[model samples]
Every structure is written in C-alpha cells, then in structure tokens.
Target: MKDVYITRISKFLPNAPVGNDEMESILGQINGKPSRAKRVVLRNNGIKERYYAINSQGEITHTNAELTKEAITKLFDDSFTQNNMELLCCGTSSPDQLLPSHAVMVHGLLANKNLEVNSASGICCAGMSSLKFGFLSVKSENSNNAVCTGSERSSTRMMASMFNEEAESLSSLEDQPIIAFKKEFLRWMLSDGAGAMLLENKKNETGLSLKIDWMEAYSFAYELETCMYSGGEKQEDGSIKPWTEYSSKQWLEDSIFSVKQDVKILEEHVISKGVESLEMVFEKYSKDPSDIDYFLPHISSNYFAEKLKTGIKEKGLKIPESSWFTNLSSVGNVGSASIYLMLEELVHSGRLKKGDKILLSVPESGRFSYAYAHLTVC
Candidate 1:
C-alpha cells in the first residue's frame, strides 16, 4: 500500500458566532419559550455553539459564497502552493448554486485560477469522500498538492416552516399526525463555517503526530433516486421562493438504513483483509486500541456516539477517555467535516506526536452510515 499523508489543514468560522445559550435565546424569542427550543439546542445535537456570517446590521447571519472564497484563499496561503493546484474539490451543503457546484466558485477564487478545480457536492459525507478522491488522485499522479475544502452557509434555509417541521418530529407528542395536510416545514440547522485540507505525498516531522496509513470505503444499498431534495419553491402570490422542501425525518431514516448496510460491508471487507472485529484488526496491526492516543469519533450527537460506543464495546475494543476527542459541545455537527476538524484541533493544540495513531471515522451523506478508519502517526 502506498502512503498518503496530510501535509496541512485549515478551518474557517465566519465572524458570527452562536452558542447553545444563544440558540436557546433565539428560539425563545421566536417560539415564545426557552424550553420549547431545548429539543434542537440540548438534545439530539451535541453542539453548544457555532459560528455564522453576518451583514452590516448585526442580525443573526447566514451562509455566504464570498466567505467560502475568502476561506479557500486563506487555506492556500497557509499551505505550500509551489506548483499549480491540479485538483480542487469543494464539499458543502450551503452552496451558492445547486447545479454548477461550489467547487467551480472556490476554484475561480484561487490565486492560481489556471489550476483545475471541481466540486464534490454530495451531502455532509461529501467532505471526506472528496478527500478520499483527492488523496487517490494525488497518490496516482505526479501532482504534488491538491486541496479539499468543506464550507457551509446554513442560515440561508433557516425558516419558520423548517422549525415547525423539526418541532413536530422532535415533539413529545407521539400521536402527532404522521400525515399532515400541510407538512410542517423545517429550516435545517444552519451553521456558517468552512474547512480546508491540503493533501500531498510529503510528511512533516514536527507537525502533529497524526497521519493516514490505510483508508477504505464501502458503499452499499446506495440509491440516488430514493433520496429527495427540494428542487425549488411554490410562491404564495405567484412569486418565486428561494428554498426547496424536503422531508428531514425521511432523510434521516434513509441515511441510517444505508449506513447500517454499509457498515456490514465494511466489516466484511476489513475481515477479509485478514483482520476481524475491532480488537483483532488492531492486534493484527501490532497496535492495541489502548495504545491509541486519541479517538476521534464522528460528531453525530450523544445518541449517535452512544450507538457507536455500544458497537465498539461489543467488539471488545478499548479506548481511553483521554484518547477520545469530541467537539459536539462547541460546534454542532459539521457533517463530513466534523471528524476532520477534531483531528485538526488535536494537531494544532500540540498534542499530536510522531507514530501516534489517530482514527478517522466519516459517516457519508445521511444515507451512507460508513466510517473510514486509518491508523496514521508521524
């Protein structure tokens, strides 16, 4: 197997910041009670605070295409850009356009516009998926550097209709109508942020101890058509609306089902590679789960983490409390970019060491419940 190491990584949070308390306050102001907002604030999502982009008046901010450009440019400035960037991929949910992809916009913003750039638009899973693709591209070619950026401006879609949808699904009322004449609309949790990672075939001796040794992804029960996306809107007075309408609960169900199937496929593939279960796989590699300095679990929330923990324990794997890192308390779920952000945070804090194995688990889309586990240490 060839080695693909991450040389540099960068993340961006816009000027606007929102914390759990702040969210509670915002929800209270709109919904008439702080407790009513608790469902989205303190429960399913393990996030307490998030950042957003703001305009001149100082209202709660939304996503911006320009910010994405700014963040990408900054990432390139920090990372080594000696030659033309052969590949540029943007993984984002809050895109400026649905058809053209955010990748082209990001690529156009580059100091080296002459470089080839593209967007890997998928759901939240697109971030790591793009990274996987970018890593493969770098490994197979002479191209020394390629960039992957995940940026989102979530506020664009946040509306009362969406909140009503979330309120209904997360409501305590079990008897709530499954079928409503007027479907409750929901504004997705819109957090404004961006993350960029520069991958190359080089290694830094003094950087974080984390590295990528092996990575494999399995896609099963993949269905693009079954997936529903809001295409556009129906305006009231014959005018056009900006956002589309989709079922969040349905999205969750589909992703969960797909993830379960995909995990089975992953376990089979890993076992066929001569490693079985979490313990056997670690042991075969001559490393103990206990030896792992940090465990970066995907930030799906306490519910999701609890499920993953149950699975890990059932497999007889041991990871120390100190080894586990989570940012859910600070940043809600950044989707595909969450685990990567956790890894970057660990490295930037001067905690990463040489030969220290860091695990990367990425859950693709809402449907592909898959994780990419790699043991890479400097």
Candidate 2:
C-alpha cells in the first residue's frame, strides 16, 4: 500500500484562553461556599489555561456543529479544498445530537461552502480512533484525499447543573464538593478546541507533508475497566434509563458529556499502556528511542507526567526533556483534538528539521485506548 501523508494541519480554539483564576470566577462556588475543585484541578493537572465556547454569561455559546464548522472553515484553503477531498472523518467525545452523525453535519456545512465531499464517516467517541480511520482510508486507497477532524465543546455547564449542592441531595455522600469534583473533574481539565488535518496519497505537491512511517493502536480495557464513561450509572439489571422515560431533570443528570472516572485505575494504567504500545510500535517500525526527534503526548492529567517519563524509561525508551513538547499546560486536554493541536504547535514553532522523526502518543481512558504514530518530515 502507498504511504499516507498529512499535507496540512490547522487547529482552532474558540474565544480566548481562560486562565485558572478566571475560570474559577466563572464557575463560581457550589453551595454558596468556596469550592476547591477548580483550584486543585489546576494545580494537579497543570492546566493553567484552556478555551471554552461560552457566551458572556458563561453559557455554552457554540454547539458541536458550530465548532466543527469554524474548524473546517479555518483549514479550508482553496488550494486543498479541491474536488479531490474524497473522505471526511469526524471524531469527538460529544456530538450535537445522536442522530444524523456529526460527520454528516460537517459535510452539510462543507457543501454549503461548495466543498462537496463524497463519503463521510465517524466514530462518535473513539478520540484518535477517528483520525486513524481517515488515515487508513487514504492509505488503503479507498480514497485519494481525506480530511480528519477532532473537535470538542464540553464545558462546565453540565458539571454545574448536575453536581451542585442541590443535586447532591440525590447522593448520600457527606463531602458534596469533593465527591462532585471527583466525578466530573473533567469539567476543569477539558476545554473547547477543534483541529483538522488534510491527508493525501503519495504526491509531488508543493505543500509540506509529514510522511506516515507507521501507526498502531491498542485497547487495554481488560485491565483498565471503565475508568471513564458518560451518562448515568447502570441499574441492577445493567440497563440504562431510556431517554423517552426521562424527566427534564433526569435528562440533564444523565445525558451530558459530564465524565465519570476511576482516578486510581486511570493513574495506574494510562502510562503503562502508553509505554507498552510505544515499544511495540517502535519495534514494528524498527525505530529506536535515540531516533525520535520529537515527543508529542496527549496526557489526561498533569499528575501523570512523572509516571509517564519514568515508566517509558523503565521500558528502555529514553525521550529527552528538550524533545518533549505539549500544549496540555496551556490548552488543557481538548480530548480527541489534543494530538493534532500539539502537532500543530510543534510544526509552527519551527523546531523540527528535515529528516527528523516525530513519535506521537494519544491515550484515552474511554475504554482505556492508546495509539502511537511515527511520522517523518518530508
């Protein structure tokens, strides 16, 4: 099969950067008292700033479709938006709606701009799995050119609406703030962002391209279990409440992108799986640790930094501190949009030179999935 190259990548963050202090002010306090969730999350996650698609009143200002539209438009240069755009693959942790798929909605927006893509596909919550789909599409010759996007707009609305002191009445826990923060800490760590990459088959174009050397993905769900999940907990019979049977209040409690996670499982397994997967991918491509010129990682929390560094070294791959670059501390974890955003920052920073190899890792607690991609600048 011919190699796939990422010809161009464009990343976007809605509104301005929301600093930790400012975000705390916006989230306000729960139960009319000082809540330490925001402060502690900022300290532990190392997320100093993030973007939110919110209005002046701090309400959700952009839907998933609107965010996707802004991202697609920002990256759509006339030179690349030719009729050759054969496939569109959209990936996100949240969608504007369940029916009609987010990819189709993006396609509709593209069509309005006269950018007609023939086939559209998506994985609603697989994170980097969605971009891998587009990569495979072009590499497998199913499409000559493709566009893949990872967009997210999850914010504090859901977290505040469902976990406030009033809502805590539903729970029998004593420390409501701590319990609520534990359940939906993602509200602070996750922010709004969209990133898109244009992929094409081997070509002698005038644009820059990152040649794909090899890519691999794995799931450690067996060991990780459901560390992170959406929706309400399942009942005794293992059935979720149907939407039709939901009261407006119950609906808000269940349907939001408000995440439920097991912190112990995530901290224990995220880095181990990442190192194991990187080892396998490196061996598969005959790549040694010394050969990697750059390291791009999408980490879930800043708390895992030391563990990731030590764990990977323990596994025999040593990444230099200078070669490591990530936007997590500044942009926060935009979920699936993270890897592309990190790559975009690195690329535009003029740090990479020709022939330099980039080793990228994306770890997701959703089903505890991890993926590695080895790329070379052409």
True-structure RMSD, every candidate: 8.2, 3.4
Where in model 2 is the C-alpha error above 4 Å? 112-125, 156-159, 164-179, 234-257
Candidate 1's C-alpha runs over 4 A off are 24-37, 55-64, 77-79, 82-84, 161-190, 205-210, 220-291, 373-375
Each prediction's Cα lDDT score?
0.55, 0.71
Question: What 10-residue stretch in candidate 1 is worst by lDDT?
Answer: 253-262
Could you give candidate 2's per-residue lDDT for residues 1-378 as a string of tens digits? Answer: 868988788887888788877875555555555555667777889888888887547677777767776776766666665355777778887777777788788777666534323322222234466667777878898888778888887774444555564445544545543535446576677888888887789743664579877778877766545666665453445343445565667655443334666677667777877788778777787777887789888886778888889898898887776678788888988888888889988878877667888988888775567777889998
Q: How accurate is candidate 2 locally (lDDT)?
A: 0.71
Among all candidates shown, the one with the greatest TM-score: 2
Name the lDDT value of residue 274 in candidate 2. Answer: 78
Per-model tally of clashing residue pairs: 15, 0
**lDDT tens digits by residue: candidate 1, 1-378:** 346668777777766457655643332222232343356425565566766564324454534446556655555543455244677867775577756767776665554647666676655666767777777777777466677777666554442323444345544566442312122112223356777777767676655433566555544334321121233332344232333243546443222111111223323332322112344446555667777777776645564566566566666677776777887667666654566567667768876667777766555433343545675767
Query: Which pairs in model 2 have colliding backbones?
Result: none
TM-score, structure 2 vs. true:
0.88
